[model samples]
Target: MDRHAPSTRCAVITPQLSKRAARAGSDRRSPEARLEEAVGLAAAIDLDVVFKGLVLLSEVKPATYLGSGKVEEIAGIVQAEEVGLVFVDAALSPVQQRNLEKAWSAKVVDRTALILEIFGSRARTKEGTLQVELAHLNYQRSRLVRSWTHLERQRGGFGFLGGPGETQIEADRRQIGERILRIERDLEQVKRTRALHRTSRKRVPYPVAALVGYTNAGKSTLFNRLTRAEVMAQDLLFATLDPTLRAVDLPHGTRVILSDTVGFISELPTQLVAAFRATLEEVIEADVILHVRDISHPDTEAQAADVRDVLTELGVDPEAGGRVVEVWNKIDLLPEDERDRMVNTAARADATDRPTLVSALTGEGADGLLDRIESLITAGRVMLTVTLPAEDGEGLGWLYRIGEVMEREIGEDGLMRASLRILPERVDLVKRRFGAAQVRTEV
Candidate 1:
């Protein structure tokens, strides 16, 4: 979690495992691709590689997570290579991790632990940090068998040591549980505050557009293109951890709040999802959703399903259905013929109005994307006219905040004449504030 500290060298275990099973029947990713993803994730954290090995476990040896022979071989390699750490690409039981670490005289980390460490390191905001810490504590709760001797104990507690301290593991779990409860309470307060803010935004009635996609699928890139603000968009898992909102104008000058949300991933840890529910409220409350897909990835289809699965789990009503715009991003990475074929197929899909192909990095097809967004949010059209006094600058500002002003002119009487295309809700606000006498036209 220390960004400034020197990078640690460790050997990757999953990189060495190869699946002999053909890819004809399984529902999982190919072994090679999964290993590549794990390694790429590890490299992002700046972990140096000393060695990589793969171990296969027999059904009977599942408790150890590796066969005895493989374990002995790993132990030999650790000693011979002077490895400082060993990273397993799969989840391991607490007993297994402890035994492996003791046998090799090196630190041992499983896939879940590695991911938690990454989340802990990447979290920036207070809420984000608290959520990550809560998830980490929940994960560590079940792995409390391993203990450290040096920890201060509570007064009057019974213990064999008879001194003033207890085992570090027990003290750590107790502290973690208390901290987790406090974080939950704080997050509940944050959620309530966010709900109030959402309600205030609703009064203006600007449509909300939420970005949902698999990790590293360029959702952030497209979000920046639409909102014209710089947000972190990197080719790494969960690069954009916090949800960001910005006002964006479509081609017709209609304004809507665009939200860039946390990217989804296959098999996302349950603890993480529960902890970050407050962050994902953007998706649930959105008037329109943009399901961005990386058409260039080999696992694109599965990735799309994964995003939808998470959305469903978040109670976004996959069947009740709000407007969904499919944005196929990273088209520039595909060959021209393949891209054309995808575009044609997308045009024909009955699930959506039409798919928009875009390269978020190079700004290709961004205008078309904006047009589609406008169509989805506006349901084709809106027209309105209102009158505001010259002194009503606050009302004029609200007009600009809500939608595009098509025309503005000062009358001889010193009143401002304004025509705008706004969402229906905004038009209602204008009518209520200025009175029916100010109305000119509505469509």
Candidate 2:
């Protein structure tokens, strides 16, 4: 075995800062829970956490992120404990990262860098890799000061310009800029391909339902349950980084395309949102949306709000004006009494449009969710009855293709009569094909 296998051991430190009472209240989640989530996320990407701590940065001296005394204390702990990496769960300026690494003699990363690393490691598809690379370059462009010592100067002809000792930061930035342009060109191609695919789906007139929720809120779990595909559903932040689409057959034999999208979260870095715009466009184009929630969590309500905030930023109306459904997922984790109380409350109140509660892990109430989706899709269908000549099978075939055939009968005049619920556009098509005399009932 290689002696230099990837080091898994790491430590986390969250610096304390004071804010207004309302701001603190809004972030009432315990630091322990946040640390646990961070650790869980690291483990999912194969990191072995050895230590975790919290420091108060408000009183720190010299450095804005880490005080000199606190830095010395952490350095001693890392040296004694043999920790390979230290993760600070807050944003740190490039200068702060360099200073902290120099003091601790270990790799130091902040929240943004850690997230970029995770995205780098998890990106699987070509477009995903390109997006990650672009984001990484954009982030690195700001932190070029971290790697200034590695640059070299050209020999002979151009050596006099910089005395043969140019900083590597300039070269790195140039290379990164070139790579970003290449990635942008490649992504443009991907965008065109995706647009073409969307056009094809639209021609079929299939309504789209997109899944959006907080990370690890069982959005992927519910998607897997409904679509029957393994989509890397794990209890980690940003587990599913790419958008996936599948054809889902409703209870009424109607087929619609369902899209599973990247999960949302609080303070999702603006850079990331801009980077993943291509992937998030799936949510924007969806006909209906499912806001999945982990109802069993103590911060369930807050989580819901966080998701809504992200959607609104993306221009999705939560009220959906009747186009969105709130899916309260993970009911299996709730106690029997709590579940009963919630179900009763949903029945009595029209608030939240009476969210549908289901255990995506156990397949509980899945049928009810399917029914709700079908109702939403078919709500605008109009009932119609029409008669066609026996030889004109095209009209009947079109009905079966575009509408749900509710009933059919043989008329005394050897004509085929049928009652159907069809989309308004398809109803017009039917009238154009069979004339007004063939139409008998319209509701």
Model 1 misplaced regions, further than 4 Å? 1-6, 15-26, 50-62, 146-170, 318-322, 351-353, 380-382, 387-406, 411-415, 421-443
Q: After superposition, how far is residue 319 of candidate 2 from its true place, in Å?
A: 2.5
Q: Which segments of candidate 2 are over 4 A away from where they belong? A: 1-7, 20-28, 59-64, 146-167, 389-420, 440-442
CA-RMSD of model 2: 3.8
Candidate with top TM-score is: 2
Q: What clash pairs does model 1 have?
A: none
Return the TM-score for candidate 1, rounded to 2 decimals: 0.84
lDDT value for model 2: 0.78
Q: Can you give the TM-score per candidate against the true fold? A: 0.84, 0.87
